[model samples]
Target chain A: QKEVEQDPGPLSVPEGAIVSLNCTYSNSAFQYFMWYRQYSRKGPELLMYTYSSGNKEDGRFTAQVDKSSKYISLFIRDSQPSDSATYLCAMIRDNYGQNFVFGPGTRLSVLP
Target chain B: DARVTQTPRHKVTEMGQEVTMRCQPILGHNTVFWYRQTMMQGLELLAYFRNRAPLDDSGMPKDRFSAEMPDATLATLKIQPSEPRDSAVYFCASGLTRQGRNEKLFFGSGTQLSVL
Candidate 1:
């Protein structure tokens, strides 16, 4: 099985709605969790970062990690059309210089 | 806005031809990485360098692929006798390492390669 799994969603939501994206992993060794955003024809950009099992908030975005359950989530409040993009979840071990493992990504669209 | 820079933003080549992609990492970053993205694989790390020395390249296909950091500013990924299966968007990323902390990576726009 793949170490990481995410729903490849083309989830459509209206503007001003709340959006939630998530991923699950089987590797308990993964300690660093991250979320990246990618627009069409562009490289992925880091959106949210969290360490271990806890929640981290940045403006309209909040990242939550539950290590025991091997699940991670990203929440977007009052979403906008500009927020339409693909969301990918990534994880890495605490070791230095280790490469990241990314999920398949979820495509989202916020309609105006 | 210092960011990783990749050359030949798009490449199209016939099968069995050689391909070379380049990257200019953000100045002062100590680590550089090469990655490929596709619908099937998502994003996969092909190789990485720390302090201008290769740390790991096990993810790359050794027979036809090579990665090198010729200097602090330049890194390259070359594929010889490329195949159709080698088509994907290749990305370069750089990070400033810190002990006991997770490094934040900044990625380049990437080179979209099509091996016909």
Candidate 2:
């Protein structure tokens, strides 16, 4: 199985709606979880970052991690058209930023 | 406004040619990473360096791929005898790696490569 796996979703949603993107991993060693957003033809940019299992909120975005289940999720509240992008989940095995792995990414589109 | 910069925003070369991609990391960032993004594979880490020394490159195909940090500010990834499968967007990311903290990576716009 892949180290990290996410549904490559072209999930369409209306503006102001809440969107949830998720990723599951087979490796329990992953300690740091991150969410990156990428626009078309652009590089992925860090959106949210969390360590271990809990929640980290940054403005309208929240990242959740469940180490027990090896799952991570990113939730966008009050989504906007500008929020349309591909969301990739990344994880690191340790504190040194080594053994980094990324998921397949889910493509999201928030329409007006 | 400081961001990682990548050169030759787009490159088109024939198969068997040598393709070199360059990156100018943000100043004061001690860690550099090279990644490739494709539709089939979302984003793959090719290699990474810490303090100008290569730490890991196992993700790269050593037969035709090589990465190096010649100086503090510059990093390069070269693919010799490039093949069609080598056509993918190459990205360079830079960050400050703390001893006990997670690093926040800043990625460049990426170099779109097309090997014909």
Candidate 3:
């Protein structure tokens, strides 16, 4: 199995709808979880970062990590058209200078 | 205002030619990473460096790809004898690592490469 798996979704939703994106990993050693957002023709940017098995919230976005199930999720509340982009789930084992394993991003389009 | 900078935002080269992509990471950030993004491969880590020394390059193809940090400010990824399959966007990111933990990464706009 791949180290990380994410559905390549072009999930469409109306504005103000709640959007949930998820990823599953097979590596139990993975410790740090991150979500990145990328716009068309732009590089990915860090959207959320979490280390523990819980939820971290920032404004309209929340990131949840469940180490027990090896699943992580990103929730966008009251989504806007500006939120349309690709979301990628990335993680790395706890270590010094270890490389990251990234999931295939889910493309999202928040309609007007 | 602090962000990673990459030059030659777009590059097109014939196969078998040498291609070099350059990055100027955020000052004071000691960790640099190179990643390639494609529809099929997603985002693949090509290599990464810490304190100007290569830490891992297992993700890179040894035959035609090489990455180096000749100095603190600059990192370069070179592909000699490039192939059409090498067409992808290359991104450079920098972060601060402390106490064996990686910090938030700041990314560049990326270099769009096309190998004909």
Candidate 4:
């Protein structure tokens, strides 16, 4: 099994709809979870970051981590067209300088 | 706003030619990472450096690829005799590893490479 896995979604949704993006990992050692957003022809930018097995909220985005299930999720509330992009989930072990394991990003399009 | 900078936003080279991608990491950030992104493989970590020393490069092909940090500000990835499969967007990211913990990463616009 891949270390990290995500549905490569070209998930389409109307503006203002709630979108939930999820990832599952095979490694139980992953401690830090992050979500990155990439626009067309642009580099990815950090969208949300969380360490613990709970939810972290920032404005319209919420990041949730569940260590027991080895699953993580990012929820976008009242999404906008500007939110249309590829969302990548990344995780890393607690070891110092450990490389991050990234999931195959899910492409999202919030249509108007 | 401080951000990582990469040169040659686009590169096209014939097979067997050498290609070098450069990155100027954010000043004061001690950690630098090089990643290659493709539709089939997603984002793959190629190499990384900490305090100008290579920390890990297991993901890279040692025979044809080499990464180095000449100074605190500059890092380079070179592919000698590039192949068509080497075509991918390469991104440089910098982060401050505080207390041995990897912090948030700031990525550059990336070098879109096409090896024909």
Candidate 5:
């Protein structure tokens, strides 16, 4: 099994809807989780970051990590068309110098 | 705002040719990363450096791919004898610290490479 597993969803939602993207990992060693947004033909931008378990909120976005279940999620509130992009979940065991494992990414489209 | 900068946003080269991409990390960032994105592979970490010292490159193919940090600000990734399969978007990201930690990454626009 892949170290990280995320549904490569082309999930479509109406604007202003709440969107939840999730990822599950097989490696319990992973201690840090991150969410990135990638627009078409552009680089991935860091959206939310969390360590271990619990939740971190930034304005309209929230990131949750469940170390026990090896699962993580990013919740978007009041989604906009500008939020339409690929959401990638990445995890690492330690510092930035170490290897990072990334999920396949879920493609989201927030339609107006 | 500080941001990672990449040059030659797009590159097209023939198979077997050498392709080099460059990046300038945000000032004072201690860590840099190289990643490749392909339709089938999604995103893969090719290599990374901490404080100008390479820490890991196991994800890269040693035969044709090489990554380096010549200085604190500059990082480069080279692919020699490139193949059509090597075509992908290469991204450079810089962070304040090393991996399993909480360091926000600032990424460049990326270099879209096409090996014909």
Candidate 6:
């Protein structure tokens, strides 16, 4: 099984709606969780980051990590057309140096 | 804004040719990473370096793929005898430290490679 799993969603939402993107993983060793946003032809950009099992908020984006369930989520409030992009979840162990594992991103489109 | 820089924004090479992609990490960032993105495989970590020293590269195919950080400023990923399946966008990202899990990664636009 892949270390991380996410729905390859082409989810569409209306402007001003709330958007939630999620991922699940089988590796309990993953302690660092992150969310990245990538527009077409662009590289993944860091959106939100969290450590262990907790929530971190940044502007309109909220990242939640549940270590017990090995699940992570990113919530966007009052979404805008500019927020339309692919959201990717990534995880790594907390050790000094470790490689990251990324999930298949969820594509989101916010329409007017 | 300090950003990672990658060369040859787009590359189209014939199969079995040697392909080399380069990256210049953000100044002062000690960690550099190479990733491959494809429609079916999503994003795969091919290799990473810490302080110009390789920490992990198991994700890469040892026979054909190689990664190196010859100096603090440059990192490279080379694929020889490239196959058609090697066609994908290659990304380079740099981080400040290996200690902070929350440390933000600065990414380059990416190198779109097509092996025909």
The reply for model 1, stretches above 4 Å from the true place, is: B100-102
Writing each residue's lDDT as its tens digit, candidate 4 over B12-73 gives 99999999999999999999999999999999999999999999999999999999999898
Candidate 5 clashing pairs? A94-B99, A94-B100, A94-B101, A95-B98, A95-B99, A95-B100, A96-B98, A96-B99, A97-B98, A97-B99
Better of 1 and 3 by TM-score: 3
- Candidate 4: what is its chain A TM-score? 0.98
Error of 1 at A39 (Å): 0.8
- Residue-wise lDDT of candidate 3 within A1-112, one digit each (tens)? 8899999989999999999999999999899999999999998999999998999999999999999999999999999999999999999899767878899999999999
RMSD of each: 1.2, 1.3, 0.9, 0.7, 1.7, 1.5
Q: Give one digit per residue, the lDDT tens place, for model 6 in A1-112.
A: 8889999989999999999999999988888788999999999998887786788889999999888888999999999999999999988777667777789999999998
Candidate maximizing lDDT: 4
lDDT of 1 by residue, A1-112 (tens): 8999999989999999999999999989899899999998888899997897889999999999999999999999999999999999998888877888899999999999
i-RMSD of model 3 (Å, 1 decimal): 0.9
Docking class of 2: medium
Q: How far in Å is the alpha carbon of B97 misplaced in model 3?
A: 0.9
Query: For residues B1-116, what per-residue lDDT tens digits would candidate 5 score against the true structure?
Result: 98999988999999999999999999999889999999899888899988888888988999999999888989999999899999999999998873445377878999999999
Off by over 4 Å in 6: B98-102
| TM-scores of the candidates in the order shown | 0.97, 0.96, 0.98, 0.98, 0.95, 0.95
Tell me each candidate's i-RMS in Å.
1.7, 1.9, 0.9, 0.6, 2.7, 2.0
- For model 1, residues B29-105, the per-residue Cα lDDT tens digits are 99898999999888998999888999889989999999999899999999998999999999999988778344888
lDDT of 2 at A99: 49
Q: For every model in order, what is the number of clashing pairs?
A: 0, 0, 0, 0, 10, 0
Cα error, candidate 1, residue B51 (Å) = 1.0
lDDT of predicted model 6: 0.90
Instruction: Go through the candidates in order and give each one's DockQ.
Output: 0.64, 0.67, 0.83, 0.88, 0.62, 0.60
Q: After superposition, how far is residue B34 of candidate 3 from its true place, in Å?
A: 0.6
The CA root-mean-square deviation of candidate 5, after full C-alpha superposition on the true structure, stands at 1.7
